[model samples]
Target: MNKSNNKLNKIIDYIRKDNGINNAIEATEQASLLLILKYFYDNSFSNTIDKLPPFSKVFLKGYKSHQSRNGTGYLTLNNIFDERIKSNSSFRSFKKLEEFLALVPFRVHSIKIVEVILHILDEIQVDESLADDYDNLIVSMTNSSISSGAFHTPIALVSALVKVSKPNKMQRIYDPAMGTGRFFVESQKLVKDDFLHFRGNDLSAFACLIGSVNLLLNGICIDNINIEDSFLYEDNKKYDLIYSGVPFGKPSDISKYGHEYHDYKNSLEGMFLKHTMDKLALEGKAVLIVPDGLLSNMTNGFKDLRYQLLTHFNLHSILSLPSGILLPYTSVKVSVLFFDNSPPDEDVWYYDLALNKNINKRTPIKEDDFSEFISLFEKREVSERSYLVNKKSILNDRLFNLSIPLPTNEETIKFDKAQEIAQLNSENLKLFSSITNYFDVTSRDIKVENTDIRTIKSLGNLKTGNNLTKSELLGNGSFPVYGGNGIIGYYDKANRDENTIIIGKVGLYCGNIHFSEEPFWLTNNAISLEIQDTSRVFAPYLAHLLRGLDLNKLSTGAVQKFVSIKKLNDIEVSLPSYEKQVELSNYFNELEQAKSSLDKLLSSFNEGISLLNKNIILEKVIN
Candidate 1:
């Protein structure tokens, strides 16, 4: 498996370096075309070309001729594939292949790159053993180039959703937004039967071609993989099972669906849910991955959608996935919605999967992580991590919110609070003592003549962040959005990583400095500071020094304060030796830690006092 993966990686690397390819998407598309051709060529009998299909024969003959010519051929393989496409008009796979090949920029340089790719593909004979490697390579390439709202569902999440759906034999399964047909591939594993039929639709021709190839590689062939917008495509056929991770934040013009869809025209997810509801056969089940905002957004469209889901369908389960599961593509916190077209149920099961660990490229979600969810999901059992919410409670609420309800237990809560208080109190005492030891570090006398003065420009670079409209912010997301003051909202994408220093750039909060410890989005109202030489000046010390310098006093403008980058760059500061700066930074960090502990200790006291008041009131009422 590793050997096959290495070869696949080589193909991707070669295409990525090729000058003909514009981006990863083009590289991935061209690579998929070559892979499909190679797959067919290797599967065909080289000893007997008479039994092979016309297209396969063309590919084999062309490849053999090219190889015979010492890999230096004036022959264009794309033209050979195009000729086969033109002759085989009835072959759906060939048409789809042509659609993908048409997008590739075939030039002399690209032909050389294709030769290298074919050589790598030739090293590994095509078989069922390469299926997993093919899927992984496609996913890796697709994700590496994912941007502009293009994303594929994680395999771990796909496997978990398939297991929960429990597809049956002979069921007509469908994925409306299937990227590379991952849902179908995962579903094939669970059903292990040839009776199942798979149908898929996608807007991207590249996705259609790659997905068709993926299905063929997995030993599952389907001719109904249509390349069109699933939303606008009119289909009366109902599916037995449907699963999708639809495109996020894309507006759908549902005017063609009639007046009833007017409310959902702006919300693509809402439209998709309604579409899924319409296309479900009697007793059909569906499991969709949607953003958290779809469930909790108080908009009328979202509320109406949730109301229909609760009153009409058997809304079985909602599994809240942890954030960062889609890192490097998006940071949207999402949840899985599992439902069936049966009569409405009185209760809905909710599971909150909190891994308590940072989910990044280094530590991605795994199949093992879903074992507990699957076990408890079968029986709809209520545990610490899983709970049930009554339909009446949801219906009676002013807004039909489907957010997961927290499991409440008084004794458990009290015990947890007591433990938290004790821990915080002990930590606060230790921090107070440690902070006092460094109290005099900042007050130490420094020889002014020995220090060197420098401008902020020499220390680092400062630039404004990307501009985002208020509507672009979500009610809840994985990354916090920072503006002039502090975090004003949340968003699904982050522009900066941890420990980044930000200064407010405009309005009332101009020149306000803040430090982030986690990945966050910086808006245009703030300026991000990137240190050029960390060895010369510590970042934390610089932040503290800037705060002490009172940057707000440097702001200009009559009605509103504005701190221009030019003014910030020209401001001079006296710098001590790197060692002294480190010492001062450490002292300030200790002080901040002590202050945080003190604040937490006070909050705990308030909680304890509130609990005591409640207990006294209860005692008096009982007496």
Candidate 2:
């Protein structure tokens, strides 16, 4: 992968160095064309010479026929005398009888770019899936260009959609906004029918050319590829399968296409929705990734569109997708809708794929991520993340809002109430028992306890933390920096080195206390407690005892909470034996661990309840 990426980078860098290339998008477009032409030409150099473009054939014959012993496949820029590439024609076209060819590199240092292209092809031939590596290269190279809004849909999403559609070789598949033709490419891997017809349309001429090459490489014919705005391009042919994830944003001059739509003006996605629906054959299935607003947007256009979907199409499934699926482009939340041009159904199965992880360019969505969703989809059974909803209940005033209910649970309401009652009662009994034991222990050692009742100042040294700014708390650091809330970030320097108890000195977390075992940098929001002598006191025991005190009541300031060092030092406390302190500290550690576990369990339980509510609440209306 590294070698393949390196070779791709070399080609893109060469394109970038060319004075004629204006932006990364143009570089990607040129690189894609060059890579494909080189791949086919290099495969059968002698036999394919006649198939090359006019000037390209002469250039390749001179470059390849040279019997160089030394392995430098560099060519001179002076040899590229092709005027057709610079002719006044669309980048993908040539007038009269001229054939198309990517413009040759113009920079002096781009002589060896052909070698890099050949290296990339070598890696790809070893594993054909590496063609996706080329796709990634194009996406990364073009990411900085303002004109580049087309992103190849993540392969995982394409695979999931294709599986759900259950495409057969006999069926005709179409993608209206086919960026690099990824949907068609991925579908070809699943559909085994040799006679499958693939068709696509896109607004970008470069995208159309790339999609054509990509489909050809993936063993799919590209006879039906159209380079026109799908919204305005009327087609009489019907398709058995249609899948698209249109660009999510406000489109330019959509009002021009208003006459073609039922509603005069709507979002780009809304227009595409109506377009695809009209193009579906009888009993044809279509899956689309649409913005979440489409389900509930109050505009008359969206309302009418949703009503049409339910009235004319069988809207079977709605899958709420996680955000960042199209990262570096748009973070808008989207959902997948699977509907057939058959009769409308009474119930719609909704799945909230609460993939809680964040996705980005660095971390992409993968095929395995859809495994569980596919399993649940096949079962068609309601689970924590899946539910069934009635069509009529969602049809409010003919608006047809299809937003699925967020997950929650009402069956556990009585259980929650009973647990709360039991928790409160247990706390009351434990408090009573603790106070009884405290009084009994102190009363017996009345004389001895009086000698040990010293101020906190004598028990330990309290030091205020050094102030650290946000900038200083980042980078490759060794020690964690602590603020009131604890471990705000990391820094290279340490102000203290000891097993110390951290006290929240100010703000909302003023009364909080935390323990640290390693060297750390500290901010002024907290103070550290370092005991002078451990034989007389245990650090953990003191921390637990201090935490039990009413420190919040002692806090000052009306605007923001604060605790002074003097107030903390002046507090008097009875001291237990060193042995008893150790015992109590160990017990406190166990108690803290147990509390942490219980907190996690409670969180998981709440999540389960939320998921349950999402499905069950809709049952009352859907059934």
Candidate 3:
């Protein structure tokens, strides 16, 4: 086997090895090494991955074993780790992190390599808390790799603008969340080598490791790095360029370590926006990634944040991020936040990427789609791109320009009243035929992939919709009660939370499915499918490929909107082979297990935040 895979297996074996009853530190150390190496090598933070030899058999066995247990697929696994360090320079104190962040190779590679060694050290019971600090930092970063890769901003989009758009050299660059330092890496291509140094805050100590490695890989010196609690810690610093992807809504009390976070009465985005502005130079440029909800929220607080961002910064341009662009794991809508430290320009350039689309839960994400956004954003021929000018033009066009609409009187008005308006007038109407069509094809294309089973597949039990009481409907619980318009309300008591998923049987919501973790009550609005015998079939596995991406393209009935099992069973099934189907199903089942493991942590999300305050990692298995 190849060296990397061998190493990976060794790491896995170390994590959960069966060495005489209780697990030994050897396995934990190995798992630790795996985590660190994966984080640093990923994203070319270190330049040596492409050349690593194949990992060993024991390592390979462990690698496959962990993968089997984790249910992580090829793309997801591939995105998790890489050893491609490209540059590096040393720095002092806080700047060491920045310098490394700016030119991340040495630090990235070193961190990964050292983390593994440290895991070994931890296994040998090393006493270096400082090394442990760095190790923890790497672990923190590795855990979020799925999301880090998800939000990778291509240099193609931001490179040219950083050089030409902003007219100042020696700029200061900063990111609030700073996952793997995409903004810094992208900025390096556009801005002068020494034009700016990196400054950013992150709740994830692991992201700190990622940014640090990314900076080192880019050839930035570590001495320039400034690490701190961005919201609470004051460095009294200022800069000419600010780039960041501050997280979405406030992650309230989501930590167990009793760390305090920004208690924004408003959304988390607003707080980050203000935080970014607080660090901006008089004529600096700030590029942020914000949600559509922020731009369109009618709340006075949101308006104030916009107003503040506008008055302090030029509010230059708003670029809409393609849907499903952030995470295949999630479908949050996002937009580019471009503005300068000066007053508003005559008109903001709004470039909508036609190639960009919404988050398609139907498909798994890859480098291809997100990379497309970067390429599209980099194309500067704004006039050629579809950008809305006045509110009239925007309303008349019937599309949401991923770009920020020029903040004209009408444009601003439309934004503040965006979600409130109900009239679908020509001024506000959208043809949206293509969007509907896409969803149509996606929902219609069913991959019935388990039909040719040779084994005795039998129904375990078919449960009908429960007669949920009206009072139960009004109760204060979070179990999803599926009905018209999907999850209409909450059910106090749940009937089936684990192992069963609900499918809409009637109405416009027909055919839609919900994954439940508890005994959720289903109203007459949906149908629940439970597998009986799996010698021939495993229902959940079949349900996996069928749930969201399957079923009818059209709503059931105009009046009742109902779908029967007969109709569902009649929809084509695409079973590759009984064995393969079961294999694939088992893989998906493992994924559910891992997800279930993570979901249990949600209850302690607030507790995690507390830990963050004290500079700790929560809910993570430490090597």
Per TM-score, the best of the predicted structures is 1
Q: Write the per-residue lDDT of candidate 3 for residues 362-436, one digit (tens) a residue.
A: 332334434433454445333444332333232222221222432322322322232323322221223244334
* Per-residue lDDT of model 1, residues 1-623, tens digit only: 59987887787788878764544555666666666666655544455534544444455556566557755433433555545334543455555555544543333245566566666766776656778888777667645543412536778989988987888886889888887788998888887765578889886666776677788878877577877677678888999999999776645245566665677777778878888988889899998988887886666888888998998899989999999887756888889899998998888888989897898666888999999998898899988788777777667664666764354553232334566567657766765665564455445554434677999899888989998887999889999999988998999999987777899987645899898878899998899988888888778888988887778877864223569999999989878888888877777776667667656665655455444433332222211
What is the full ranking by lDDT, best candidate first?
1, 2, 3
Q: Per-residue lDDT for 1-623 in model 2, tens only?
A: 67766666776777777554545665676666555544433333234334434334444444554425323433332333245432423322222111222222222223355455444444444224446667676567535532354546777888998887788887888888997888887787786555678888887556775666676556666657776678777678899999898765556466667476646354778878888898999999999998887876657888788888887899989998888877766677889999999999887888887776888777878888888789888666788888787777766435467776644655322235456555555655655555555455435432223236768899888888987766777866899898876888989889987688888887545768888888898888788888898778878878888888857667864223578899989978767787777766776666666555555555544444443333333544543
Compared with the true structure, the alpha-carbon lDDT of candidate 2 equals: 0.68
Candidate number achieving the greatest lDDT relative to the actual structure? 1
Write down the TM-score for model 3: 0.44
Model 1 residue 350 lDDT score: 86
What number of clashing residue pairs does each candidate have, in the order they appear? 0, 7, 99
lDDT score for candidate 1 against the true structure = 0.73
Candidate 2 wrong stretches, greater than 4 Å:
2-6, 19-24, 39-57, 60-130, 138-149, 192-195, 262-264, 411-623
